[model samples]
Target: MRLFILGLGYSAGHFVRKFGGAFSHVAGTVRDPAKRNDLAGIEVHAFSGSRPGDATLERISEADVLLVSIPPGNGGDPAIAAFADVLAERRRKIIYLSTIGVYGDHGGAWVDESTPPQAAFERTRLRLAAEQAWTNNGSGHVAILRLAGIYGPGRNALVTLRAGTARRIVKPGQVFNRIHADDIASAIMAAILHGRGGTWNVCDDEPAPPQDVIAYAAQLMGVAPPPEEAFETAEMSAMARSFYASSARVSNAKLKCEFGVTLAYPTYREALDALWRAGEGR
Candidate 1:
């Protein structure tokens, strides 16, 4: 199998790391020249502009699977648009990494694949549109992975806690869902190996209040937990505040039932605890 990834962000990085040599050929794109050397052994190409390089195009055409991790933005994805014609012709399987934010504020309700996306935020609305663009381009081989807030290793919110920057903002009964990077990678692998297409949520089974998570991380670090702030009065940037606006208990039942996969870290406590121990070199 051949795999070509259009984006090299954190999720894509984990995907390639977990499935690099499984394919006969694996090629990826990065925006930075300095980072081009980061994807050693695997073919890496620069893609700052809309145009796809010759090597990148060839890799896409020959790829059995094309994974796109570029998040939705104002201008949308030019690389995907640039290769839409060839992609339509190749009939290659495509996986687009999306976010559960597309579901909008569900009032902490559990949502599954059957639920229609009612994106209430601009970013998620853009994502919904991007999802449509890909589906409208061609066949049904495209699979969309709607991931939860991804945390693992150095990227965990625990780092923010340890830095004494963690905030405990209680928004009544607001809840959040998160998934580990390893679990996200495993879900992608399951989707690929099983050849399943359609939307699937890749999240952990646990959903907890934001304050509880902050307190838990602080407790594990043996530090006094930060005091709570009024959710409405909490001082946060527009983007950060926007993120806290939505609350939902994202379901992973579809992932387990359909993909026959179980999370490596089923709960935030387990995941954060593991990361804490690992950081302490225990």
Candidate 2:
């Protein structure tokens, strides 16, 4: 199979590293190909979410599978905005990586794909619109993976704590679901192989407090965790504070049942333990 990815960011990059060998041809787009020295041994093209080059468009047309990891912007979905006509001609499998934040603040309650998306937040509202844009315009099989907090490798709590940047912000009764990057890759592969169109919540089995993850990471590293700060009084950016607005324990039962995916790390504990063993913070 031939694979083309749009907005090859963290999770999508991991997916390529883990599963790029599965495809006969693997190519992807980055905002600036010249800056991505790490993306060696693969085709990398430049797409700033506006006008795509002719070569990139040709490859996109030939791809059997396309993975979109870009979020919607002020002009709406970038891929659709740029290549709607080109993409409209072909039939292929599409996997869209979305966030569980679309469920919004659920009062720490469990939510599934059937729950109506809470469009209270503008970010999530755009995400919902982008989801429909892909589904309605792709002219192919589309699987939307509603992901949770994504962390892995150099981006985990272990590294953040060692850098003296880990925060233990305490919000009473707030819990969030997270997914390891490896598991997300697995889900993307599963959805591609399943050859079906649907939406699935891709997250770990555990819904944990943010502070708990940091404390556990510190414990694993045998170091002191950052002091806790109450959410109300904590210093945070508007973007960081916006994340705390949603508190849903997103369910992944459908993903498990349909994709037959068994996450390598079912919770933050296992992920942290494994990362520690691999010398993440050292």
Candidate 3:
């Protein structure tokens, strides 16, 4: 099956690296022509100006399955809306990557697909609306995967800590669920191959304290862990601090039971250790 991906950022990069050539054909869209080189060998199209070009619509028509890892637009994707009718007519399978942040500030409780999204923050509320809009409006089945925090090789807590800036921020027991980028790719592939129309939480089994993760990464780097910043005292941007304020652990049971998939790195400790061993400290 041909898989067309919109957006070539972190998650999209993982998807492309893992499944680019495996499919009958692969195509990707980049908002900037400068990034067209990044999607080399696969079919690349530049979406310039304020809107999508005709070529993008044509690519959507050709795809059997479409994966959208782009950030939720202010009012859902205009690009997707541009071809929604054609996409529905083609009956394409869609995988829209969302975030567990939609279930905002659960106070460290476990959440499942049935959990109503609290969305304490505007960004998450927007994402929730985007997910619903695509699923309800499209004729094709939309598999919404509410992903947890994503980390990998150069883009993880290990690297952040090793950059001589690991802060043991204590929120007095706030917890987080994270998934390895490779595992995120695996989960998406599993959904494409085995899942039906539904929503699932994609996260590693272990939920951990942020401070503990920071300490472990510092130990691996052989450096004194960065200063402890109390969550209230840490100088944070409005957006950054707001995200940290959302404190909860997500449940991955639905992902495992529904997709029959297993995470290669089931815990942050294991995943971070592996990353450090790979010389991620650069």
Candidate 4:
């Protein structure tokens, strides 16, 4: 099997690292050609503008599976806009990475794949649109993975604490779901093996407070926890504060039941503890 990735970013990079060997040929697109050094074994091509070049189009035609990790811009999904015709004709399996933010605020309630998306933010609205675009373009060959906040090695609260930029922001009754990068890779692999096409929520079992995660990381690192700041009183950027608007516990029952996925790190505590033991937060 051959795989083509539109964006070889952090989470997608982990997927490639874990599953690239399974595919006989693996290729990906990067915004900068210089990042090819970072992609290692995969064949890399430049794709910054809306449309991909002839070389990329050729690769797309030859691919059996396509993973789109690229975010949509104001103009909509770049990949869809550029390659809708090509994708419509290929009949290849597609997996679009989306966010749980598309569910909007549920007042700390549980939201599953069955819940209709009520996107409040422009970013999330674009994600919902992108999911629809890929589903429409791929016909019945698309699987949309609505992921929670992604955290893993080199990109976790541990890294933030070590950098001295960690903040223990407290918002009462607020909780968020998170998924480890490795689990995301496993989910993608499972989806490929199962060959099921639909929407699925990919996240951990726990819905935790933002401050608790930081505190856990600090304890694991044997450092004093950052000062607590109330969300309402804290000085934060519009983008950062916007995150506090949504408070929902995303469910992964569908991922486990449908895709038969068993997460490597089912909660932040397990992930942070493992990262700490590996000398990550030194």
Best by TM-score: 2
Deviation (Å) of 120 in candidate 1: 1.7
Could you tell me the TM-score of candidate 1? 0.94
Q: What's the C-alpha lDDT at position 69 in model 1? A: 87
> Which of candidates 2 and 4 reaches a greater TM-score?
2
Candidate 4 per-residue lDDT over residues 75-118, each given as its tens digit = 89988888777786667778889988899999999989888889
| Model 1 segments more than 4 A misplaced | 138-140, 280-282
Clashing pairs in 4: none
Better of 2 and 3 by TM-score: 2
Clashing pairs in 3: none
When sorted by lDDT, best at the front, the candidate numbers are 2, 4, 1, 3
lDDT of each: 0.82, 0.92, 0.80, 0.89
Residues 71-95, model 1: lDDT tens digits: 6668876655677777876676788
Angstrom error of the Cα, residue 178, model 2: value is 0.5
TM agreement with the true structure for every prediction: 0.94, 0.98, 0.94, 0.98
lDDT of 1 at 7: 84
Q: Positional deviation of 84 in candidate 4, in angstroms? A: 1.2
Per-residue lDDT tens digits for candidate 2, residues 1-282, read: 999999889999999999999999999999988888878767999999878899999999999999999999977988899989878888999999998888988899889999999998788889999999999998789999999989999999999999998999999999989999999999999999996799999999999999999999988888888899999999999999988888988999999999999999999999999999999998
What's model 2's TM-score?
0.98
Candidate 4 regions off by >4 Å?
none
**RMSD to truth, every model:** 1.8, 0.8, 1.7, 1.0
